[model samples]
Target: MSDIPLIHFLIVAAALFSIGLAIVVTKKNLIGILLGIELMLNAVNINLVAFSRHDPERLGGQLFALFVIVVAAAEITVALAIILRVYGQYGTVEPDKIDGLKH
Candidate 1:
């Protein structure tokens, strides 16, 4: 098999980021928005890993990616907890109808 090109990885990562952005912008459900955020985070991680391929040190990108992953995990936990509370209070997870915060 031929070695994968860096440009190919970059293009795929870009596509993923765009799709995630679209999902976040268009989705009306809280869970769907959360998933799109996760997908965008993953696309960032992919770009970091792919760039680390060129650098001999390779430490910077990998470290940044690790930080991103840890932050994403923390975000997911907190967001999920909030979403659960919202669901309990409102009986639905639609983002548009979550008007309790506006007051």
Candidate 2:
């Protein structure tokens, strides 16, 4: 495998995290929020793998990244189910318009 500088990986991760944060903050749809969260998780994964590669004696970061990936997968399933249920009940996925719990 060709070697890559750590800083380059970190920069990419930071960019992904920033974009995901913006999407999470400004998006109205539940699915959009979920997508943002996934993006953020992927950014974290990238950092973890990059760090682990530099210290191959211990694979802690890589293992942790694997766990994060598994957790994100589970989160996607549950989040999509919740979003679908909310959309079914209200015919909308916009956060501001979802006020059914207040009643």
Candidate 2 clashing pairs, residues 3+ apart or interchain: none
Badly placed stretches (over 4 Å) of model 2 are: none
Model 2 per-residue lDDT at 74: 95
What lDDT does the true structure give each of the candidates?
0.91, 0.95
* Candidate number of the best lDDT: 2
Cand. 2 Cα-lDDT: 0.95
Best by TM-score: 2
State the lDDT of candidate 1 residue by residue for 6-87, as single tens digits: 9998999999999999999999999999999999999999999889876847578888999999999999999999999899
List residue ranges in candidate 1 displaced over 4 A. Answer: 101-103
Residue pairs in clash, model 1:
none
Give the per-residue lDDT digits (tens) of candidate 2, residues 1-103.
Answer: 8899999999999999999999999998999999899999999999999999999899999999999999999999999999898888888999999986742
